[model samples]
Target chain A: MSALLDVQSLRVRFRSLGMLRALVTRTPDPFIDAVCDVSFHMRRGETLGLVGESGSGKSTIARTVMGLTPAHAGSVRFAGDELIGLSSRDYKAYRRDMTMMFQDPVGSLSPRLTVRSLITEPLRIHGIKDRNRRAEAKRLLEMVGLGEDFAQRFPHQLSGGQARRVGVARALALGPKVIIADEPTAGLDVSVQGEVLNLLARLQEELGIAMLVITHNLNVVRHITDRMAIMYLGRFVEQGPTEEIFHRPRHPYTEALLSANPQPDPDAQLARIEIKGEVPSLMNRPQGCEFHTRCPYAREHCRQVAPGVSHAGEGHVYTCHYPLNT
Target chain B: MTQASATQPIEAPAGAVLLEVRGLSLDFGSSRGRVRALRDVSVSVPRGRIVGVVGESGCGKSTLAFAIIRLLAENAMITAGEVRLEGRDLLTLTPRQMRDIRGRRVSMIFQDPMTSLNRVLSVGQHMIDIQYRDKISQADKRRRAAEALTRVGIADAESRLRDFPHQFSGGMRQRICIAMALLVEPALLLADEPTTALDATMEVQIVGLLKALQGELGCSILFVSHHLGTVAELCDDVVVMYAGEVVERGSVRDIFKRPGHPYTQALLECDPGRIHEKTRHLPTIPGSLPDLVEVPQGCIFKDRCPHAFERCQRERPPHYPVAEGHTASCHLLDETRGNHS
Candidate 1:
């Protein structure tokens, strides 16, 4: 199948300091690249996970794909239509086929609006006035496993899980073919996190909609994603089938990240590879391999020269001078 | 590392009791009414062992930690309990005596490092301020502060001490918090969700540091967190709390391997790490926690338990012994009653 949503050579940059401040400080470069040459594609009904630490540009990539953040240079095509440099009016039509669910469930919803109005706001935004909004709200709520009584409730009255369900309802109100959920199970208890993950899984299976999951939670990524990518300082360190990467990761960063996650089973043998130091600042990124500063297997060559793309197996690729388990 | 170990104050014998709470029940007088925050909660931290109190939000895990350090809110009333440390009842101590014990004998690490740290103060200043009660020289105190920072894996400890809290990253700030908390060489450390605010890599670093520090310092830790995987990895003993009550208590192996209580079993099954298959639906506990404003008559988890019977609905279940040093407050384990439905 052809790619449903494809992003290639995507580069996103942001102003780290004002021009005046940069000139006063004698800084040569004011713009910092949040995302650098990241590429990925999703077929119809596929789920792709973007995994990274904080400030690794997972959300920036999502926003850039949504056209909310302007890209420095890239190609974003959805269903054979190029989305880059499109006008707001022209983008409105794509908005119906691609919707985003924000990270904070409660804060994303307007406090003053009732659940009925909140869910149907997308329909109103697209100038769809023919359908009954109250009925539509009920349908959306039912789709998210919420009862009809929740239509009259405000955002504050709902729990974190309930608010997340409402957010899912709102995202589905437009019947988007692609849903970009940023941390769908964040700020929820273990049980509630399961409920939300299950709901998303069932929804994807039922509607056959492609999903782009952006989260740092590896367990969530492992459970929901078919393909996964690891990001370091906004660059794709590794990308492959989820199970293949989990069992046999080629990149040292991917292996360390998987090992760092605490397994619930106490008997699970842990061969943890502890990475040292903190994530490097985007402003002062390392000269060569961005993760070499923390990588355990980093050598002198890795510090002096950037590594090119290396393939591990079918559909598995990593950028490392000496990939692990080769 | 050698210098820090030489200054260890007390070497309590292994397997000796350090802090014990017996039948602790607390109530908070709120505008909505008196809310029963904790009920008959009991836990013991043995010398040099980490006892984790695992629970969800509103489970009174944090409140139990505060009650231990005598830092409860103004309106919190401890109706029934005896908090004993080193075989002496701490509940009978005066405020002045309690103040002395707080930092010198028992220290705490809160969830958010930003709120706990003073923004305007330098890291060295905060470290020096915490040692006001010590009678050591200024140079000795500074040396100890730098040693503590170094022990927690912070590079350039001497120079970074001059930097402010904002100068450090989230992981470094939390490392500082851990360092400061352990500087006093307290007998018992209360870490309330210390790594919840950190990233995965950072969380691993912090957990490793904590394990190493606890091993060297020989201080008992009452680690409270909602993350089951973390508790399973770091804690030696486990106390599972639900709706302000300890529903199960056992060694980490016993609790994780053979959970007797239905609530605990359900909680373990709900963890994404435990669910190995890629299924359309994940298992979940169906209902919410019961209200605690009024004293509950039946079992706390009766509403949500899958194995709840008539006996559970009519009366509260006592902590029934499941195995050696393992107990669960569930009627299903009551073989004497023979009334499990």
Candidate 2:
């Protein structure tokens, strides 16, 4: 299988001024690594769920893939083509093959524009100048389970679910091969979240598009994802098949995440693994493993040396010194 | 189901039924017309018991909280209801009487701590202001503020109290809000989605803190949230609301095990974990919430219910007893023809 999207050793850093006369002197700019040495691959028709807490640099990786933010070091390849070094003209053309869906649907969709104009704006921007643009927009809306009448209504007129459908329609306007959705159903109700996930699943099956779903909800990954990756502080702690990772989780962080999630069952009787303390700031990340600070099974070596990725099984890799159950 | 010894009431020392809401209904009146926000909603929070009001957005959970505090906006009116706290009907209280009761007897912690806490004032000032109104000495108020902050697990409570709200993180700001709500030691604490903005680990920590506080203070809590799983873990009783009406009311165990209402079942099935073991795709309750202005004459969930019958569309279903204390308002429960009344 050919990789549709590939990122290697991606790094993003932002510079901040130091305290005391640095603002006046304009010197000693401190750099914070938002994304550090992150790598992943997406194959066609595959869904890769990126699970992480806040400040985990998941959104940074998404933005870097979309070319909204430049990587400090590493390569981004799409279909064997290097997208990192693409010129502005070529990047614009490359962007037509990829799109992103934001977390907040209402914020992403312009309140002033009707559903038709919002969906068709991408087509118009890509120079698809034709009278059939409106008809194509209506079709896109219908495909997303909205009626043609919604095309004439503004964003404020639509509900949260309807707004998300519109966002999906806009992302599919150019028929991109890879779609990156960031927290697609975070604030939605449980029933609506299921609907959105089902919609994404059906769309992926029908369109044969690769998807990168970034979310904090572990249940979502277990339901819709083919493969999953656990991220903490701009690093992939574990990545593997969804079933294997859920059933036989190797990393302690992964185990804690699963345990922290409240299952619907009343009699499950699962051990509650409570993670103590707050997530360290990216500016001052801990030495060795980023998760060593919170791992319940951390040893002396776990805090002194960063663990490298080791293969646990077929297509399963985890970065932990002492994997659970040996 | 293993029932707790009914004879030996699970009681909190110094505990009593703090708040009892009966037939509460609220309406938002605009220049054009009136919109019914709540319809015949009733709930009770016993002292020291954590009663979780679970529902999705626009289910009138927050409105119920605001109405209890008499904090509803001018455009909104309590059409019909009685809000009683400790044998006193809050609905009959004037603004001045409500002011005396607001912090001393009943206090609310809103969802967004960042917005709820005054940004311009320091955390200590906010606590001091809340305490000073109760006629406590300034030194005693400061001591109580520090103690309250320490109770919520805020380290360096004395020094941190001098900092402004912006200086605290999201979770820390919430802790400060919790401290403010606890400073008065109110009989009933209304927490409106207190953990929604927090991370999973922080949420657990805050909920644990709340549980500890409930154990020590013996204050009843009306916890409003959209997550049923959280309610299952933390609450003693659960009220499932849909479109501003109570669809199901029962103990957490009974509700999770055998949900009678179709909406309750659909809500349970909508969760991925419940359906994870099955081979079928996840089931969704189809359609959105009904428009409040034009509420359906029958069941509000009939539009999305899979088991909707002719009667469900023509008449509202009355509450049917399912268990010792479990009740559901659904026509499916009526099929047995056994009425608890």
Candidate 3:
């Protein structure tokens, strides 16, 4: 089947504010390449995981696809229609088919709105009204594992888990085919995280919606996604089947990332394959390969020249000079 | 996290007991009401070992840590308990005395380094504050400050010392905090969710640095965090707290392998990292943490526990011994007690 959403060479850059800032500053224009030439696609009813650190631009990619963040270059084709430069009038219609679940549940939700109104807000925007919207709200609440009793409660009245449930319900209000869950389980209690993840997984299966799960959590991606992409320094370093890439990562960065994730089992012996130092700021990113500074196997060529994409067996492909052993 | 093993006799598990908290109970008297944050919470941090305190938010994990250093909010008061550091009760210490012990003996690294470290102050000034009690020369303070920064792996320590807190990245700022905390070489360090704000990659780096530094420095760390994976990785001993109570306490291996308490078991299962066999529904505790303001009379975890019975709702369950030095608070263990009290 044809791809549901196709993103090609998507580049999102944020300049150091505009207008008033430009008038105040004399230094050369500073910009961070939030998403640098990232490309991927998702089939109908498929789940793709985007794994990266805070400044790795996974969030930028999500926002770019949603047309919320204007792109510097490239195309976001949703069902063969270009999302870039879509007029404000057309963007509203485009939004009906795709929705994003934000990271902060407490901040993302309106304090004044009850669960019913929060869920129904999307429907109301699209002109659906009255009793049907209320019925749909109750259905959405139940869909996310909340009972009808939750519909009347305000955001403050609900717990963190309940607020997240309402967030998911609101995202599904428009019956979107594509769901972008941006760190959906972040800031949640471990037990509550499991519940929300389980609910999202269950709903994805039942509704058959294509989802782009963006998170720093490797475990979440491992459990939920069909395919995965590992982003580093705003670039997609690796992309393949979740199992293949995880079991035998072809990229040096991916290997380090996988090993870096602390396993819950106390008996598990950890290998010291961690990358040293924090993620580099986008402003002062490495010259050639973004990961060369941290990559254990980096050579002289790796620092001066960016590695090209090397295809492995099956759908596995990674941009690494010396790939990890299978 | 910072507690003495109050009711239990000090088995003294091969390491010198650095900090011992006994019968620690804390209450926050708000306009809403008095909320009992900690209930007879006891923990012992052995010398040179990292003890992990794992629990959900508002589970009194931070409250217990802050209370040990006597840095709780104005509304909060330590109603009962004693925190003994080196056999001396800290609860009885005055504010001035407590301030002296706070940085010199027991230093705390909060979750956010940005807020904890003064925004306007240079990284070097923070070190001088800690060394204020000592009549060290300005040069010595600067030299020692740079030395501490270098120890934590910050590049160009001399130049970085001039940089403000904002100039440093999240990971770098955290390193500065750790450096400043360990500047005077405190006997014990109380880290309250130090890496929660950091990214995963950054977290591992910080954890590694902490482990390496702890090994070299030979100082005990009372690391409190909600991330079970991180806790398991860094800690030798694990204390699982729920609703202001120590539901389970044991060696990391014992807790992971044979979690006796239903809450601990549920928590272990709930971690996404614990997924061995792929399944649609991840096992959850099924309920939120019980309200702290008005704690129930019986077991605090009874409402969410699958194994809880009528007896669990009626009477509070005391900690029952399991393996050597391992104990779990549960009514189910009462059967193993052979009907004894």
**Candidate models: Cα lDDT each:** 0.90, 0.84, 0.87
RMSD of each: 5.1, 4.4, 2.6
**In model 1, which residue pairs have backbone atoms overlapping below 3 Å?**
none
Candidate number of the best lDDT: 1
Expressed as tens digits, the lDDT of each residue in A13-131 for candidate 3 is 89866756766785466677888888899997899999988878888888889988899999999999998989877888988999999989989998998889899999888886554
In candidate 1 the C-alpha lDDT for residue A105 amounts to 95
Instruction: Name the runs in model 2 displaced over 4 angstroms.
Output: A18-29, B1-15, B134-137, B278-280, B335-341
What is the per-candidate TM-score for chain B? Answer: 0.95, 0.91, 0.95
Tens digit of lDDT per residue, candidate 2, span A1-326? 87889988889887655565566775655678888888889999999999988878899999889888878899999998998867667888877888999999899998899889999999888898864977898889877999889989999998788889899999999999999999998888888888788888899999999999999988888888889998888888889998889999999988888888876766664698877777888768898887888888788898889999899888789998889955
- The ten-residue window of minimal lDDT in model 1 chain A covers A263-272
In model 3, how well does chain A match by TM-score? Answer: 0.95
lDDT value, candidate 2, whole model? 0.84
lDDT string, candidate 3, B47-107, tens digits = 9999999999888898889888988789988777789999889988888988889888898
| Maximum-DockQ candidate | 3
Q: Candidate 2 at A148: error in angstroms?
A: 0.8
Better of 1 and 3 by lDDT: 1
lDDT of 1 at B237: 89
The TM-scores of all predictions, comma-separated, are 0.95, 0.94, 0.95
Clashes of 2: 1
Span of 10 residues, lowest total lDDT, candidate 2 chain B: B1-10
